[model samples]
Target: MQTLDLAVLRTLIAVVESGSFAAAARRIGRSESAVSLQLKRLEEQIGEAVFVRNGKQMTLTGAGARLVGYARRLLDLNDEALAVSEKSIDGTVTLGVPHDVAETWLPAVICGFRRSHPSATLKVIEGRSAILQSRLADGQIDLAVVLTATRPANALWSANLPMVWIGRSDFHLKKNEPLQLAAFDPPCFFRAAAIASLEGADIGWSIGHASNTLPDLWSAVSLGLGVAVRTPAAVPPGLTVLDGRRGLPDLPPLHVSLCGPPVEFKKPAVDCLRVILEECLAVSIHAAA
Candidate 1:
């Protein structure tokens, strides 16, 4: 049997992720025909079909599923090997982040990181906390900046964050009334906390509006759509805390931290990247305060 080629393996992984040969081609900056040819050659080496295609949609066969895991490990190892020899603070760190956090502090963090490690590249994916968590589990991201963290696990980085509710000073609170809330959809940790607090307080409340997008929700809050529960760092311009009002029991502090393969912890590139992330968090706290 012929030896497996890493390039071809990487190509296959891309195709599986991208969902089509054409998409994979675009991602890798190769022609579709070239990607198809690579897949053909890869299958020949494996002695079985690696993909099942029906029209444009493709699914990984059992063999392809097995190979997918191996391919990611191989690529990670490939990166580590390259990093070892270079011994330079230069490489890419894919980060999954929350949208509001990205809007507020990511730029400063990126700028600071670049000044210190110009060659270190950043690829950011912005989404809600739950989505970011899924990406972290899948190895799609090297590190994540999230609201909460778990115990020191084999494949996790954890930290506790003190979060707060923010609103415009003009936002009025009726004494003994339910708090009006502007929030995102379900599974949003902050939103869940806000709702639970109001209900627990037996305060009469109403939803001003809801959104799946952070910008829309922010706009709602800015226009006094309603008050929102957010991290201190995320209170937008022209907003202030509604201090006299209290809802629910004390909200659990948000935990923000990073998680990735334990092997990455040993890599200098990963360590440098983590420092950049921690720096970002520090700036966030200071700016919010």
Candidate 2:
């Protein structure tokens, strides 16, 4: 086996980014022939061609595309290694969180973390709670905030927060008009709960709109399209809570949990992030209460 050269990797990345050998050579401060030779040697070592020739253009072959992805990540890792050698606590923490939570809660949480540990970078991936949970289970992120019907596996903290029913302030209905809802598609706890509650109450209700994403659904609700079920902390601005004339049960509170990959949680950086997230969660829960 032979050693892989960082110079070759750098050249490959530059070529990919620049989209041509000449441009790559110019960007990396190397002659075009030198760049081409480095790529040929890299391909020989890897036993595959790294790029497809198209006149003056260059594109990665399937194997080449995959290798470029790995090469880019390796370069990023090398950069981080160098950065961490000089700076304290330098690394990336990928966090998975729900969309609504990110919109309402993440800025404050990130601001606090950055203030305390400026060298540690944060990357946030926002999606539905279920998707975030899957990513956490796969060790794709350092930590996550998720909602589950029951206790989440291997979690450090859990709290129940009330989900509220809200409608636009300008919305009007006949005396007997039942609540109509704008909801996300299936696998959404809020949507399921809203439907279950309305059906159980025998209200004359219907699905006014459905969105594959939360922001769009919230937009629809804010436009007086229909009522929406949301966590109290995330009630859209300018919306009013709706109530049944007869006493009705508050929507079941969602169980928010703090979780991470089991191994990563042992690191100090991960632990610091855990504490920060828990503190933020506590403040949010209290504020909503």
Top candidate, metric TM-score: 2
Off by over 4 Å in 2: 1-88, 170-178, 246-249, 263-265
Report clash pairs, candidate 1.
Answer: 147-255, 148-255, 161-254, 178-203, 178-204
Q: How many steric overlaps are in each model, in order?
A: 5, 0
lDDT over C-alpha atoms for residue 4 of model 1: 71
Model 1, TM vs. native: 0.61
Q: Put down candidate 1 lDDT per residue, 92-186, tens digits, no spaces.
A: 87877787767665764565455556567878899876787788778787777777534435335555655566777766666766566888888
User: Candidate 1: misplaced stretches above 4 Å?
Assistant: 1-87, 149-159, 175-178, 245-250, 263-267, 286-289
Any idea what lDDT model 1 has? Answer: 0.69
lDDT of 2: 0.74
Candidate topping lDDT:
2
lDDT tens string, model 2, 97-162?
886677666765675566566778889998888888888778788788887777787678889887
Residue 232, model 2, lDDT: 65
